[model samples]
Target chain A: MSTASVPLPNWITYGLMPLLNLLVAFFISGLVVWWIGENPLEALRLLIEGSLGRGDAIGFTLFYTTSFIFTGLSVAVAFHAGLFNIGSEGQAYLGGLGAALVALALDQYVPWYVTMPFAVMGAALFGAGWALIPAWLQAKRGSHIVITTIMFNFIGAALMVYLLVNVLIVPGKMAPETRTFLPGGQLPKLDWLMAWFGLKLGPAPFNVSFLIALVMAFLVWVLIWRTKLGYEMRTLGISPSAAVYAGIPYARTVIIAMLISGGLAGMMALNPVMGASARLQVEFVGGAGFVGIAVSLMGRSHPLGIVLAALLFGILYQGGADLSFEMPNITREMIVVIQGLVILFAGALEYMFRPTMVHIYQRFKRA
Target chain B: MDFFDIVVSILGSTIRLSIPLLFTALAGLFTERAGVFDIGLEGKMLAAAFASACVAYLTGNAWLGLCGGIAVSIIFSLIHGFASITNRGNQIVSGVALNFVAAGLTVVLGQAWFGQGGRTPQVSGDGRFTPIILPFADAMREVPVIGPLYANVISGNNILTYLAFLAVPITWWVLFRTRFGLRLRAVGENPGAVDTAGISVTWLRYRAVIAAGFLCGFAGAYLSIAQSAAFIKDMSAGKGYIALAALIFAKWKPVPVMFACLLFGFLDAFANFMQGKAVPGIGEVPVQIFQALPYILTCILLAGFIGVARPPKAGGVAYTKER
Candidate 1:
């Protein structure tokens, strides 16, 4: 990639390269499955059936996809500003507080439609507030954002535990969780939408947040490509020196990009807190924040690519839960291994096969 | 318990707890000093913990388990090297990927082999690193003041604790006194200069990473075999990050690394000491405060509130001939 001796077409660079990387990742993941004495093909089959075979499976898949989209967009926005916002997990965690507060306050007074916007704002504001210190550290203080964000993740986890155990836990309840949200705070399931496709929706948590995710994805595209701040962010990401030469304010762009990224991450809470459980549970973010990095990288930081990648992961997640039989060896955690492999090949070793591809292309052209 | 007993117990546990941080922070010291920023310490430590515990259970030999741990950790290091050093890809991205892989694969494999809810079987007999009672421990126990301290706080620790304390001085000696240390630090600060002097920058960085892996093996092995009985799920539990925090809090110095780890370890011991108990003046202290203390302190340090902690000049950047 650094050499760039042979210029490749956009189709090969964007399309073929990522697909090749993804295949290698899956192949390695298959090897792990086989190592654990499970049939890779059987695992794959179960995965597909469990995620997409039935209406309920699809609904669950879409539910997971909704969270992934928000997190993916969060990571993508940060990526555009040359920031690795690993604190999305923490941001999303805090976002839960904002959302739970909104639901707890308004479930009795207002309808779902009226409360949804305020919930969104609350979540985003809290999430952005979490990102503020890390962003300031990176933008103004020259601290490494990666280290700070990872630290904040632990801090956030600890803070949440304290809040849940000491403050939010309902009296007479053993569990460290808030009271379940009422009907007005709950997100309505997309049963009608599924019916439009002739699929009968079951007890899956897939809901209106999926629609919000889609709209947000489109808005992210607009924010990255069509806005002045987005252009400045791109300039800053590509080359800091170039951005400085262009007189783009580094601190302002970094802070703004991170705030937007954090807000997007915060929005991820809606899918789980409001849509799924309708309550803020301990550790509910559930590593969706990390899955976003893989989604963003695999998607090449484009919203369109992120959607497809998010769906692929949603399949893996939903299907993995249903994997069992003679070999229950491929646990839900096997999906995490797959995610890591995807990050390894697609994110870190992205151009591992490029040199060979270029060599083959040159020989073919010469012939 | 009396005040003396409480203080003695806390100090003893502090020594017990800081051993892992000592090994891991030293591990990170070597790697970061060589100009590669390694966030995958958590992953390597974790994988090593699983591997060592598995082998320890199978062979019933703690030494063999230690070997297994080191070998597995080194494998991870080489993978990181290939990705970040050879391919010149993003080091942080490679590290993040490895962390995820370790977090996932260890549990997946552990469950497959043992079927104990993502944990290895509890190892006993010679499979464990038993605490060694010192020569004077019995004799000194009856003496006043220094007696209890000598008997408990300083003595009766496992081999890893002794080795961990010894490592600080050895690390300081190796880093400041040796020619290889000079070259390693020089490579980190200015790889081009080291290259100009006819040293292979790639080889130096690789050696540093391998050293890190070897030390992290001890850290991981200490967690599973020395400190506890078995490899539980997520047992490393951010010790690696706290070690990283210790590194930054120490400003990457070896002697201060020891003190920093002790400070963090004392926080841990104190938290456990005060759990479910309230102080006279203050209310029940949430254990989470201690859990988050290292990270919060590191963040403050990194933010230049305490001091400017400058990394190796070329840290996290791959060395390129063209550059």
Candidate 2:
């Protein structure tokens, strides 16, 4: 029977549905755990404890959360302008390069406080630069943004490989990575932030970038909801025909939204390169861009939702790492499985349970 | 190696590499022509590769492995169908989810089953698709021109490679000549029209996606059982996306799809052949250029810099009868 004709409550749409989807995703993930002869309930306990039990674990979890927040916001921004950007992985890669260039030039001379702002701009610009062509193609040429973005991801990888191998490598080093950034380039740890809880923050790389991520989230919220440009973007996203009729300037809105998206994705590099590695390396983005898509979908493309969703993934990643250590049979890739299930249940089959829920809700109301 | 031998080797490698692309691109052609966009071909092929390798190692039969691969791929296709068709969800998001699931699930299952660091044990004997020597290949090897072309390029390939080539003409016939073809194409362009005409849009799309799964399964089986000895982590690499790019490059037609795969396969072969080799004037070009060529060319084609590559009108949209 046809369903979903009636509007459900906002509480159901935003809150109950997401919670149900997450539970289903976790349930299936537990099945995978069971298939490998592990106790799913025990595994869940270990996951929660490993990610949140200690100060260092919490720091690590929040560190991962920071990157996811950037990426999730990236996807959310583009999504608002009716673009599905799958190239944030590549953009983040380029963003790392942008961040590295700044860190490299200034680390020997200036303090990180002096280098931070420029590095942020550098990362965002590089990421946006990588996205420019796909955005331009989608805006002006009517090319499918998805395909172009996907292709650009490969091209960006190739370019990065070429640069790292041929140009950026230190003259005497064997590795493709650049030399380590000095103290000026390095982000100070948030150990103090952790110590305030009277717990030692051991080796976690939680740093100032988390704060930046929050600021970006707030900015994204403002851009999507408050500004005139955001209004045009939302207008274009909801209906291109309607936007055109309303004179929303489709090309400008699309390009600007993508730039913001790409820039946010690019800023994800700050957490890893400047905060953790203190140097740029290959594969630093490491599927965080893809995780962003999941975060955005799960969060319903809202900034507040994205922050929470990113935190959820951060817990999974940090906890999954611990689970792998405890149960060798389950690898770190288990987190990826959980991530996919979340996307499947929350993003695609979001309404699969909606009809059933609506039916039950209506039945209860009738009673 | 002599020039002729080099040509034969490169040509042989091109065909070998292109088979997966050929199969996968043709698979995409069907689903996309029926108006479903899938970015999960890579994941499907990777999952199927792992499944095929796992089954071949256990059953000691490549055919059984092939069946296993196809079965798993079909299951994924059904999932995609359930999401996009029945649930009326975002096709790209659904595809993205499937890709991740396949990628993560395969490696996880592989590690759990084999305990070889996410790699299946190498399959040999009947578990592998050994090349069948075409008649008179040794005799023809000594002859010039057509002899080496036929003996080396055409012959000495596994059964799946030959099937990949044959699928091209069959795909053309099925896509353009049959009643199902016309209806499928119509649905991709205007599902509403097809629905109004009393044809089931969902059923037709599901069939198209299943056909896609069937072909992608062959592609994955070829990758593990025919092309390689065992499953490797991320072994499909970006071939699925390359095949998707090729599908767009071919503009979703069967014959053109074959050519696009061949072109990409040749680019790959040529890149590997040219690695560490210096040109007379330009010096040694980086191999990444060749690696990136297919994507660059596809991007150019996509931007209407070359001939415009138009997708089906109703592509990427979930069709609802009520709408």
Model 2 per-residue lDDT tens digits across residues B13-88: 9999999999999999999999999887888888889989999999999999999999999899999999999999
> Which one is best on DockQ?
2
lDDT accuracy of residue A238 in candidate 1: 96
Give the per-prediction TM-score of chain B. 0.98, 0.99
Model 1: residue B39 alpha-carbon error in angstroms: 0.8
Worst 10 residues of 1 chain B by lDDT: B314-323
Clashes of each: 0, 0
Which window of 10 residues has the lowest lDDT sum in candidate 1 chain A? A323-332
lDDT of 1 by residue, B17-134 (tens): 8988999999999989999989899999999999999999999999999999999999999989888888888888888899899999998999888888789999999999999999
Off by over 4 Å in 1: A1-3, A324-326
**Tens digit per residue, CA lDDT, model 1, A91-137:** 99999999989999999999999989999999999999899999999
lDDT top scorer: 2
- The residue-by-residue lDDT of candidate 2 on A157-240, one tens digit each, is 898888988899988898888889999998888888888888777999999999999999999999899999999999888999
